[model samples]
Structures are given as C-alpha cells and as structure tokens.
Target: MTFHKEDQVLYLMAEHDLATLDTVGLKKDFRTGYDSGVYRITHKQWGEPPHYAQAYFDENKHLLLFSAMTDRGFEQLVEAFNAFGHDFPAEPYLRVNLTMVTTANEILKKKVVLNEYHDLFQEDPDPESEKVLKEINAFIALVLPDINAGRTPGIEAAIRKSGIDPENARNVMESVMGSLEGLPGPKGKSPRKSPGKSPVSGKQKKLTKQLPAQSGEGVRLLSGDDELLFDLHLYGMAGDIRREAPWEYLFEDEVFGVQVPGKDLVYFVSVMGFEGEHQALSFYKGYEGLAGFLEFRAEVGRLSLLGLPDDGMLQASTMTGGLMTIPHLMLSFTDRDDLEKEDLAAIKKSGARFRGKGQWPRIEEIVPGHVPVYPSKDSLTELFLVVQQVLVVLEKDRYDDQYLMREEDPDHTILVRVPTGKGPRFRWRDHYLVVDPKWGETSYAVRISPASSVALARLPEASQELQLDLFMLPATVREKGSRAYFPFVLMMVEKLNGLVVSMSVLSPQPDLESLYESVPQRVLEELIKSGHRPSRIEIRSDLLFDLLEEILEKAGCRVMWVDHMLQMDEAIMSMISHLS
Candidate 1:
C-alpha cells in the first residue's frame, strides 16, 4: 500500500492473498512532497506500525482520508478485526464508509459509489447488521425475477422514492447493489421505476418492547408471572441442582423490583433458592422481558446476552443451578399442546420423573406459548445442533472426575449429573439449581474457562487420561480397587483444580498422608528445574492454596489474586504476610 502527496491519491494493492503487509511503501519522489508538508498518511494498514500522516481530501479539499505507514500500526487495526476468528467487515474502508454515511451526504454518496470499486473485496458481515442484510438480500433474490424481467431498473431509486430516510440510504444501497448483481443489462438499461414511490420504507418499526425485533413472522406474548409459575422439570441432566431444590423458592417481600425499559408493566419471576434466600435477580440483567426465562446451562448465558442467534426452529433461555443441578429443559408450548397421547405420555413421564421429586414449581406458573418441552424423536436428531449453539463446555472433560466417559463411546458410557435411580428429585431455579436426595443428584450446569476448553481438547493425551469419578460414592465401595476408587480421587482433584500426575504419587495409596508430604518436594524441584514458569506448576492437590502461598513467599514473588466469586483481581506484595 502506498500514499502519494503530489498526486493527492491513496493506493492499496496486495502482493498476494496471504500477504500480511506491515509498512506502507512510498516512492522517493513522493517523499519530498510529504517532507515539505504537501501531504500525510493517517489510517495505517493491518501490519504496519504507526506513523504521523496527513489526511487526504476530496476535490473540495475538506479532509477526506488518511493512510497508515507503519506495519505494526496496520497490524493493530487488523488484529482488532480478526481476533479469535470472529466475524468482521473485510473491507479496509468499511469503518470509513460507516463514518461517512452518518456524517455528510456528499461523503455518504462517495462511499456508496466506492462500494462498486470494492464490492468483490467485502466478505465478513457485521454481526449487528447481518440479519438486516440477509433479509434484504433474501427479499431481493425473491424479487429478482421482477428485476430481471425489466420491472425495475434501480431499486435504490425506488427505495428513495418510497420515502426511505436519507440516513438509512447506505444500507438500502447495499441491499439494492447485492440484489442488482444478478440483473440483466447495464445499470441504466433496466426498467426504470419512479423515485416517487420508494421501494424501501422510511423507518423500521420501534422494537422498544424487545431486543431488536427479529424479522420472523409472528410475535408471541407472555407474562413474567406465567413463566415463573410453570413447573419445569429437567432430570438426568448433568449437575447437583436437584439436591439444591429446597433452596429454589425463597420468599420475596416485593412483587417486582427490577424494570426493563420497554417492559415496565411486568412482574418478577422469582425462583426460591436460585438468587438468594429472599433476593431475586433477573435472568440476564436488563433483557429478561424480551424472552421468557434466561436458559444458562453452559457458558451459553454469556453468549445469549450478546444476542447471538441459536440454530433451532426456536431457541429458549432459562436459569438453573451451577455444577449440581440437572439441566433445565426449555419448553415450547406449540408442540406440547399438539402432541398425541403417546407423545404426551412420554413427556409427562419425563416431566413426572423430574418434577415429582418435589422441587419443581406448580404447573400453572409457566406461560402458555412456545416453550422447550421434552426432547422427542424428531427434535433429538437436531438436539446436538441446538446444544452446540446454546451450550458450550467450559473445560472439555473437566467432569472426568465425577463422570468419566470413554473416548470410543461418548453416548454409551458418559455418566452425566442426572439422578441415577429414578423418581423426581431435583429443583429448578432461574439462576441457581438444587438437587435432592443427595445420592443420585447431578448438576444441570458446570463451569470451565473458554481458553482451556478450546486448546486442551485437541491433545491426544487428554482423551486417554482425563476421567471423572464421583467423590460421594457408597461407603461399601470406598476400599475397592483402583478402577472403582480412582473416580472419587479424580473428582476431588478436579474440584480443587489439581493436575493428575504421571507418577502414581497422587493416585490413591494406603499411606495417604506420608505420600502427600514427599510428593510436593520432588514435584516442586522438578517443576522449577524444568524451566516451568511459576504460573504453570501443577500444585499438589491437598496443598493447592498452602503450597502456592509457600512457594510465592520463598521466591519473593508478588502475586495477584483474582477471586472466582467476583472475578476481581487484587495484588499481593508478600505471600507470607498475606497468608498470615
């Protein structure tokens, strides 16, 4: 990429598709013009470092654009867009176009015209605007026959004539351009439509009552009280939530304390033990009213808040327990009401098994519209697709302790945190979950870091060694062989966030206390000598907190403690003093 001052032009060309261009290339002839203050570059390329550059201007000489000179500077800009393989606008000038579109009419006009030059280069969609673009493109394709048949020449003109506000003209133009790509003849040759009857309308309807309203055909309404009252049952799911059922329905003095802007006239859907004994929190903060309940089984809670669309006929959200409750089943009422006797019987059986445990609320609390009922034969096939979109594993196989699953047989051998012996034994909540009768209860949700989940799943070693074993196994089997006993040990190690060592040291041994004392010294010496950073050391299970404190003190290392509770970090200068 090069910028010329005397020519008053910005030039961008790629060496090849894989080029990671860093520094801006400028000919020596243009250097003098720039040195003498004839011109400057501003916006840098993706891989370039920052450099002082003057702005480019249009024919009127009012600041038009700038180019970046340093490779590092350009890299920073590209990093902003390409981080995490996330979707981002491919055109380098997209931000510029957006700015122009919102700022000045002449600039906006220039941007649309420039789109013709760079249209082929554009790829990534704006997460916010993609749906609108999708709808527009779909509508255009649907009406393509009309366009090709000479019914319309310029859809942009038709949109303008339909009274589309000038502010939204850019979006209208994109839709028009994408659709017009398939039209016959030159730009001016197609049938001309009057700009008097705008093809695009002026303003989108106000979706104040919900999050940006989706373009899906119909709308269903329900009261918060209704969803709150329904007795939703999720059993045989992972987690210990059923044990916590006693905690779900804590009484609140007030009816509704929180308010969503568009949903002011709403009631609170309070589950007893999920929030606190008496306090109630909204499912996903402010947007609770847009959907019935915020369903958060995995890290889906975080993604749902960002408004990512789920890949089902419909997606639903509700709150449940963490690491100890059964997964809450989101029900859609449309299918449930339409179910035949056998299907209804199967649903009621699953429902009875989950809710009969006595923690589920009365049936009347649920709103009477579309909800996620029990998985049926047809829906089960699509279950994985829905599950992957709405649910994510925090740490892949972190549950190897409580539910060790075989790599060869995921469906057959995996022991999730669902009740084992049958009967209703779990409690559902908006935020937290509870499982009862302690023995067979399981967690509906679990926690794992996003970083660990992605990278560690690929290593072959993880698949063979990582296992989940229940800690609270029957006393009769406590002294069983390693095959039976190791699971409990695995559960303990996982709970405390300790690593399973290759040496049989941490594996259950008869003289446990003596085994523990000798292992740490050997491990610590080996770890330090192996050039391991302080952060990477696999601490001894029993000494996780204690040894961490000791080593930091011995090394005179300053440490920062970030609590999992609030996820807030605090610096500790001396571990000895802090521990004291």
Candidate 2:
C-alpha cells in the first residue's frame, strides 16, 4: 500500500495519526499474520538500482512493527531495536523510504512514534535516490499482486533475472520462506505448523557424526628440538639478526633461508626492519614457493599502511620525534599474569624497548599449524635460537656460494644454512631452498580438532531445539596496564521462543588457540548444566559449525547451518548493548 503514490502521500499526511496509534493497535492493524522474525524483500526496477525492505516483530517490545526501506534505513531500524533492551537515551531516528522521509521520536521507546514526514524529492532531491526510489516502486508494483493474494512472491526468480548469483538468490528465498513458515498461504488457508518449531526453522541435511582422520604426514609438530630453537632465540638473537642480516642489505623481496639437519623442510625468511618501518622477521614455508612469498609481501605492504597511527597523540608524537613506533610483533603485556617470571626477566634482559604501560615485550608467533599466539617461555626461547642461527648463517662466509646463487636467481632459489646436530658441536652446511618456479603450485592447509569429543558424547539429548552462536564482542576488556582484547561469547537460546538458555564469556589471553580449544568443552558443560541437549541446533558461523558439528552429532543432535538466526542475532545485540 505505501508504494502507491496517493497512499504514500496520505501516509505522510497521517504521520500524527499513526504516531497516536498505540503499539498494540498498530500491531493488530499492520501485522503480517506471521510469527515474529525478520523478513526481507528486494525490489529492482528496469535500469535502476535495487532497494531493500525488512519487516520484523519484536518479541521484547510492543513497537518494532514497521517496515524499513533501503539498506541504511534497515540498519538504523535494527540499531534502534537493539537499543530497546538497555537504558539508552532517547533520540530522533530518520529513515528515507522512496521519496518520503520520516523521523521517529524517542527511538529507544518501547513503543516508537513517528514525529514527522516530508517529501525528500521536493526539497534538495538526490538524483541517485530518486532513481533508486523509482526502481523500488516498480518492484513493489510487480510483487503487490502476489502479496495481496497471500501467495508466495517470485522473489528468487526476480533476483536471478536481475543478474544476481543463483546461490545468492536461493539464499534470499530461503530467508523469506523461513520467516513465512507457519503463516497462511493462498485465501487465508493456514499452513500446517509443526508444534514447538521455530519461526525461522527450515529443513537441513543431516550431518555425519564420524570425523575424517586427520593426517600427520607433511605436518610439522612442536618437539624438544623446537624448544632448543626457542632457547637459542632468547640469547640476544633479535639484535644479532638485525645487525648480521639487515634489511638494508637484504631487500624484503630477497629470501634468507634456514634448514635444520635431518629435517625435510626449509624456511624462507624476510627481514623487514629498514629505518622507519616495522622491525620483524617474516618466515614462509619453503614448500609454498614464490607465489606465497609474493602474497606475504603484499599483505605486509597493506599492514604497513594500516598500522599507521590514526589522529591521536601517538601520531603527533611520532611526527614530532617524541615517541618511537614499535612493530606489532612487540606487543605490550603489562599484566604479569600473561607471562611467567622467567620469561619476563629474559625479555627485560633482552634489551627490547617497550612503550605505554607494558613493562615487558611479548613475542607473537604466527606459524602454519596454530592460531596466532604469544609464545610461552620455551617457545619464545626456541624462536630466538632459530633467529640466532639465522644470524650466524648471515655472518659466516661459508654460505657465500648459496647467497651468490640466490642473488643471481632471486625468484627461484634462497640462501639456506642446514645445521648438522644440536649442542656445542652443531655444524652448519650451506645449501639452497628451491621451489617450483611457477605460481599457484603449492597449497597450505591446517587441521583443527574439537577440544573435547568425550564431553560431547556424554550430553543427553532433549526434545527442545535451540539457536547457538559464538562471536567476539565489539567491546574490549583489559587490565589497568595491559593490552586490550575483545572477549568472545558462546550463547544458546531457545529456538522457538528466543529465550536465552546459556551464555559463556571467554577471554583470549596468552593465545587464541587456548580460547578456540576451550569452546567445545564449554558448550558441552553449559548444555549439561542447563539440562537441555537440544534435539536440533541452528547456527550461522562456519567456525562454530566446524567446532561443534562432529561432537553434537555424536550426541544425537542435528546441526544446521543457516543464513540467519533471528533469535540469536537479537540476543547478541542486546548483550552487546549491555557490555558496551
């Protein structure tokens, strides 16, 4: 109706009347006769941009019964809905639908009121907006007949016709159907609604419970030798690497290589410190070859630009020679709880400079098999030892032949030093780390396993179903003198009613692996404690699905990966507001 020109004008004129209508009355009049959930519809006109509209019913409030037009308007409406759970201050929220602009007063109100409306096209019209509005109007006209007849709209076909990807079109239709589930079909004929089923529920293929065997071949594991390498790193190796293999002499594009004796692999290292730049050594697996190095180089270039301080005292001080810019590798860790006393002492003695409130430097090791982590004392020591070995190779003249070869063929080969054995008698042999000359020849893969499969098996299946989500909160938490980090939350809510069943917050301190590995067990504990095994669990995150799939399936629970979880999202937004 609002799409009609005369109705649109009338709606604008009746803003006061609409505002005067209580939320209950408005719901009774405008309700879509569907369960509470977000429904999206897209309209596209010939030779015009697409416009989107989303309508939702709020389970927690009386208002939130209106439809939003355009992507920006939809986003604003969602934000306002989220703000309703908290004691957010009242504010005016504006939305532009087609040519009409409406402002809502007390946007945080449980029952929202439209303050006023105006014709945007009449006063300072934007050509782009007008064009988009026209397209939206055309799309509305196309779908109005189906909507009035209570028939499912041909949204997917329309989307496909508009040149959208078939898969994306199917996803859009899935959302629409999921939201329209249990609603009446043609001629007000009610569809068969499954008892206790969620409004957003949909049929999903059952996932296999048995996990594939993880291969250990070609995978590097942390061993005692690795510990030895980290120990070598702690004995002033970073400074030695900087002095012996300066990036000024060895360009970032040139690779300095290292290989341990009796090992089948070689590591290609790039030194980055070259005055007014990040001081760090980036290592790439030799198996990855030339393209991998190029990719790493490109990522480093992007990081360098992104790492620049924003408009702040740090930027001003750096410009005025009052502060030093430290590499992100040397992140500050003022909290002693984050580090062992011995490691802290070693770091302090290592002569590493730190700024801000952090008293010691922490090394962040990002390797092939593990999550980015602040390495433990032994691990840090091993890394430093490897750096010391690299420094030794750079300083020695025995590797001159390999270095010369690498210099001549920079793209194909790298200078490498292989150690014979550990201990004081360790001897070095010069060699070249060679790779396939062609690009895209190598692939890097890492296998992750659920932390606790046993706990998953012990979970008792229940009759109820639930929506689950694990996400990092936007708000950060930190101790008085420590670096800040966003905390993660694992939440499970009753799928049908949107009631929060369980919520667990985890801190990713020391390393991300610790946090990641702890998730499965936490989910199991929460489910067992709450006495809800959930016959079916729906989730949107690939990470959560990966972590919980095998385990949950073993417990006789089906896992469904969907495009959206209405209840889960709303709950998360409320949690975020409280946290913020």
Candidate 3:
C-alpha cells in the first residue's frame, strides 16, 4: 500500500511538471493568473544563485521547495500566506505550495512552506476533520466567485478528465457565489415609497390617526344665569357669591360634534387671593374645604369618583342625575340654593334617581341650604414649588373676588405646553417654560421681552416673574388602546404681550420604542383606571414601517432598497415617499 501511494504521488508530480526553465518576456493565459516564463529573484542573499528557484506544484497537491533565498524573503512569503489565508480555499488554487530552503548555514529560515494534502484530507481519520472541511467549504463560497467564473472551463475539464462529477464542482462554485451575494449592509434597507400613493399622504394619515380627534368631546360647568356665569356670592347665602367668595363657570363648546356635560365630572374648587403683592393660595385652598370635607389628599393621580360611568352614561351627568348627585350625597345641601337648583329640582320632581346612593339617606334630610365653602390649608405647596422649578409662568390672574369673569379668565390665564419626552430645553421670549419631567430639573426660567409683544396690546410693566406649578403628567395613546406614560412637565406661563405662549423641554420617559413594546399591558391598565375609556383605534402594520423609515431619515442615514422593504411591510408601503 505504501509503495502504491508513493507511485501515485510520483505520477501526480510528473503530470504537473514542466522541467525546462523557459526564460523569456512576459506571457499571459486566461485560465491561470500570470505566467511569466522567466524566474528571477530581484532581492535575495548575496551568494551563488540556485540552479532552479521557482514555485513548483504537482497534480497530487504536494508542494516542493528549492532556492537560494534570504531571511527577509522567507518572512515575506509567510506574511503573504497569512494575509491570503483570511478567505483562502482549502483546495489550493494552483494545487501546490512552494518553499525555498537554504543549506548554506544549515538554516531552514530562507522560506518555509508545508504543502497541505487536500486529497489526503478527504480520507482523514479525525472526526474534527469534517468540521474543518465544512468551514473551508464555507470560506471557498465566500472568496472564490470571480476566480471560479474565470476558471470554469479548466476546472470542469479537470473534474471530467479525473472521472469526478463535473456537475458537483459547478454546484460548489455557484453555492459560493450565492453565499457571497447575501452579506448584510450597514443600513439594512432604504426608505420605500408607497405603491399607489405617495408616502407623505400615508404619513399624514398615520399621524392623524395616531392623534386623538381634532375635535374633543368634554363637558363644561357653566352657570344657568343669563350671562351663563358661575357666582360664589350668588350661590352663597351671605351675598352675591361671584363678588363675595369665589366661583368658576365652565363651558363646553361641543367641539368635534360631542357634548360634554359639566355635572358628570367632579371639580375640586379653590380660591386664590392676594396676601400683599405676592399671589398666595394653597393647593388645598384650590380644593376649597372639600379636601377635609371629602377626605381628599395631596396625591394627584386619578381620583376614583364614586359615581363615574363605565359606559357612555356621562351624557346623563350633565342632565343632572349622574355624578352630580355626588355633591348632594356628600354635603346634604338643598338644591334650592344651587345655581341649577330650580332646573335640577324640576328634574328630580319629574321622578328620576340614577341608582340612588344605596347606603345614604335623602340629601334634603341629611342637611339643608347651600353647601358652605370653607378654606383648606394648602398641603401641596412643596409639590407646587417643585413644579415651579422647571417651568415659567407668564400671566397669573390675581382676582380678589371669589368668582372672576370666565371671559376674563382666558385673557389673563397662563398657558403652558409641557414637553412629552427626554428632549432639550429651549426658550421663547415672553413664553412660559414647560419642563419635561425627564429633564430632572425643577424649573426653567424664560425672559419675555416687550419687543416681542408688540403684536399684543403692549408689554406689561417690563417683565414679570411668573411662578409655575406643574400638575399634568405626560401620557400617550398609540391608537386608542395603547396608552403610555411619557415623562412630562406642567407649568403655567404668564401672557406678556398678546400671545399665549409656553415652552416645554423635551424629556421622554418610557420612550416611544418601549411604549410600542408594552402597548397591550398599558392599555389594559388605563382602561381599568379610566372606566370611561375612549374607543380603540387600529393601525396597519405598514404604518409602523413607514414611521421607522421617517425616524431613520430624521436620524441621518442613507436608505436603500426601500421599495423592497415596502413590499414586505405593505401597510406602510404607501408612505415610502414621505420625507418626514
């Protein structure tokens, strides 16, 4: 067997040999890379040159060494192998390895090459050899595409003459090319345009759909008098409550074609009075004596009013039978004293009680006359200060009367727009600052110059420092179902000239990405808490893809193959052209 193997190796070497060295000008062959007949070492050791000093390869895949080379040359040879080995194929391109071993000083360092036995590896004894083969196969697929295409004919002829399946060889080459074609790019896919329409339209639709309806449906608490105004003294027994104590008239415009009633919702009323030059009123004062009377606390999450409806029954709250009963149930006051007393009593006499307080007695018998309003000590002063730290209040209404004109409220009321997420803080002159909770700051100051207020009547005396208190929290709903708590800041800005302005620093908590991930969980929690939850709005999968594309573009990335991605995310395909 050993002799037979030796003979086979010898035969293979003889088949690939071209003994006579042909020293001549440069020659080229399409099959092999470069074939210059002459072999010369431009820089080698300063000694007698070898008779033959060139790389020799055999058909058996064995390599032979020869040459009078220098140490530096050998180092270059090793380095070349390493650099090429990154994506080198197991089966040598030329079927052999070449080396130059020096005998002058018994030093083998001139060049060293170990001919890797490709055929022998096929019959390997070690189990790990299979893994190595797989890796080499994968490598070949990665790096030999252009070479395979160029040498297809020679490789095919070799396989056929060797009685090997030429088709398998072709298959291997194709596989390598295919694998190389599938590598990923840095930017996965480009932004795509929608099929039938532009992405801008789709994006606009998506934005619109994502938002709550432009028209809102909320009830207002307005007085029944000719002026439709709320009066504290009028409602009080001592004098006209509008001037004596304090009151507020709420009005619902029925925007978006929805009627919102004032009585359906409970309002924690408070009165603010000037204690000298400074505006001084406790948060508890805002709640009136209701804080102690109704056992209210400073904690301002959602309040579970006892009489809210789970269904669309809030319409009845305005008609007088719904949650409005809560006040009478608690205070036990006569309806005759209320601003809505006559109208309310007529409704009550008409025979109707929205599931009467199963435990409480008739309100008329419990107590009589108007529910007296008392002042409560402010307990949320610290919380208010915390809010003031991050926001700037521009216009603060300081009215001595308990009930100020509602019409006047809009003109003098402070307007504040809180930021939604973790974002930067910017200032607009004369506008109040709205702090984003994610910013972690207590307050942000804004300077309103009178120059900017020329459009309005005139600048208030120079600039006034308006202290703000943030009470609103950031929240979002993806459709109607996905409600997320975004970090937000709340504060009132004083209106300087004529513009109602407020600035908010962007601070996103539970960012948009996280909100989408936990949409379902958040929706369920919000639903249970609100009891009167809004209807859910469903969105197409394509909308998400479109949004992603817009966000990526905004983040500054090159988009490619957008059309293909659009096809995959069909819903958003229509939004491919949208720039933002």
Model 2 stretches with alpha carbons more than 4 Å out: 1-237, 240-279, 282-381, 392-417, 422-425, 429-488, 493-501, 506-547, 554-556, 561-580
lDDT of each structure?
Answer: 0.27, 0.45, 0.23
Candidate 1's C-alpha lDDT?
Answer: 0.27
Worst 10 residues of 2 by lDDT: 9-18
> Between prediction 1 and prediction 3, which has the larger lDDT?
1
User: Residue 578 in model 3: shift from native, Å?
Assistant: 35
Clashes by residue pair, model 2: 229-382, 230-381, 230-382, 230-383, 231-381, 231-382, 232-384, 232-385, 233-384, 233-385
Which candidate should be chosen as best, given lDDT against the real structure?
2
> On TM-score, who's better, 1 or 2?
2
Please tell me which model should have the higher lDDT, number 2 or number 3.
Answer: 2
* lDDT of each residue in 544-574, candidate 3, tens digit only: 2333333323222222221111111221112
Model 1 RMSD in Å is: 25.3
Query: What TM-score, to 2 decimals, does candidate 1 have?
Result: 0.19
Tell me the tens digit of each residue's lDDT in model 1 across 273-357.
3454321111111223212222222235444565544521011111111211122223221223444465445444433332232
What C-alpha lDDT, on a 0 to 100 scale, does residue 576 get in candidate 2? 60
Give the candidate number with the greatest TM-score: 2
